[model samples]
Target: MDLYTFLYDLATGPLLWISFLTFIIGSLFRAGLYIMASRKMDKVTHEHFSLKYVFLGLVRWILPINRSVKKNPVFTILGYIFHICLIVVPIWYVGHISLWEDSRFGWTWTAIPDEWADYMTLTFLAIAVFFLLRRIFSKDIRLISTFSDYLLLVVTALPFLTGYFLSHGTLENVSFFGENMELIHMLCGELMLILIPFTKLSHFILFFFSRGATAVEFGRRGYSV
Candidate 1:
């Protein structure tokens, strides 16, 4: 096979599977490590843990009922929008749903309209740029930011950008590094999945545990987090 076909097959087949498996296994391993460390270093957190407090904490933060939300309403709203679009658009896009239906499992689900997916993708990209600017311009945030922080933002945004291009045929006639836009999109998505477990994106899995533990600790003292 030629290079393009080879790359396309690799991206859609083995590499894709490897990325998914790595994400799942790595996330579980990280979670296991966190549990072990927490149990060993902070016995009190578990000893006094309350499921009620954990649930409450998750609800408070998940909604806009927290102090942080109150203090930074704009940022909070943008964050929610970004996350929602980030999650919803990918899972609900017509193209993605079709792929699922065509897969060996033949899973199928209703998808959002193509127009809606387009709008959401644009919104996601806009918010990603906003976040990058915030990190660069906000003095306090900048002070705490590292190279990895900026890199993660770019990594997170690239798949969406490339996907948008692929969907709209934005660069269909152009080839970069001997690869088409679809290949780039696939690679970016796979790279993101691979990185999620190792990067701050792992918060997708760890957020509940960390937030719940904090809530329990504070709740035991008659406080809210």
Candidate 2:
């Protein structure tokens, strides 16, 4: 098979299923492990369990002017943009939502205009660049950043860059890889899905758990008062 045909088949068939399964199973495994670890760490009775603080913790994180914002307001805003686009663009883009409906759900809803999704993708790309630069130039961040940290940024940004290229036909005039950019974009996206559970991208899962745990601890303290 030619490069384009091979890429298309690999991206849409085996890689898609492999990535989705890996994401689902790995996320469940990680969440289960967190719950088990939490049980071991705190042996409180079920009667004392309250979700009040957990809800509150989520609110705290979602709202601005908290600890994360205080640490660095600019970075916090950028983070919010990155995360918001990460969620909004995928689930709400017309093409993507249509794909979901066709593939599994058989249901479709109104999507944000393609123009807005394009703008959001640009914003996400900008944030990724800023993050990479911060990790490089900031002494404290540089000290803590592992090689995987940089790799993570690259992997996360790859799909957006390639997708933009595909949409704009930015590389179509080129001979070697231009024709295959769409498949490359799909491959990058699938790879990102598979990597999420194994890498710091697991923050998507752990963020909730960590906040919940903190809230539970706070709840216990409140009960004593």
Candidate 3:
């Protein structure tokens, strides 16, 4: 088989399965570790755990009805937009929904229009650039940022970048690093999935646990986080 066909098969078949399994299992393992550490180091967190407070904390932060949001409205707005697009575009895009339909389970769902996906993808990319520039230029943020921080930003944005190129045929005639855009997009996506559970991106899952714990702790003190 040719190189592209070989890579295409690998990316779509075993690699995809491995990426998903790693993401799911790694996330669970990390979560378990967090729980164990919390129980051992801060038993009071469990003692004070309140499901009600946990839910409330998640809602408040999700809606972002917080002092930080109030203080930095522009940043909050952009953040909300970025996150919404980041999540919605990938799950609801027509191409992704088609992949789900083609999977073994034959799952199918409604997808957003192609136009909407394109717009959201562009918006997401713009916001990602904005965030990167902020980290570079913002004094306080720059002080706290590390190499991993910038690397993570690039890693997170790469799949979307390549997907945009693939979808729009932006570089269909041009080979990049000796590979077509589709291969790059698929590899980037698989890389992201594999990295998610091992890196800070695990916050996608762990955010709830951490937020809930904090809320429970604060609620015990008669305060809300």
Give the best candidate by TM-score: 1
Candidate 2 segments whose C-alpha is farther than 4 A from its true place: 44-48, 222-225
Q: Give the per-residue lDDT of model 2 (tens digit) for 60-150.
A: 8877746779888888988888989988987788877888789865888899999998999999999999999999999999999999999
lDDT of 2 at 113: 91
The stretch of ten residues in a row with the least summed lDDT in candidate 1 is: 170-179
* Structure candidate 2, residue pairs in collision: none
lDDT of each: 0.92, 0.85, 0.89
How many residue pairs clash per model?
0, 0, 0
Could you tell which candidate, 2 or 3, scores higher by lDDT? Answer: 3
Q: How many backbone clashes does candidate 2 have?
A: 0
Sort the predicted structures by TM-score, highest score first.
Answer: 1, 3, 2
Q: What is candidate 1's local distance difference test score?
A: 0.92
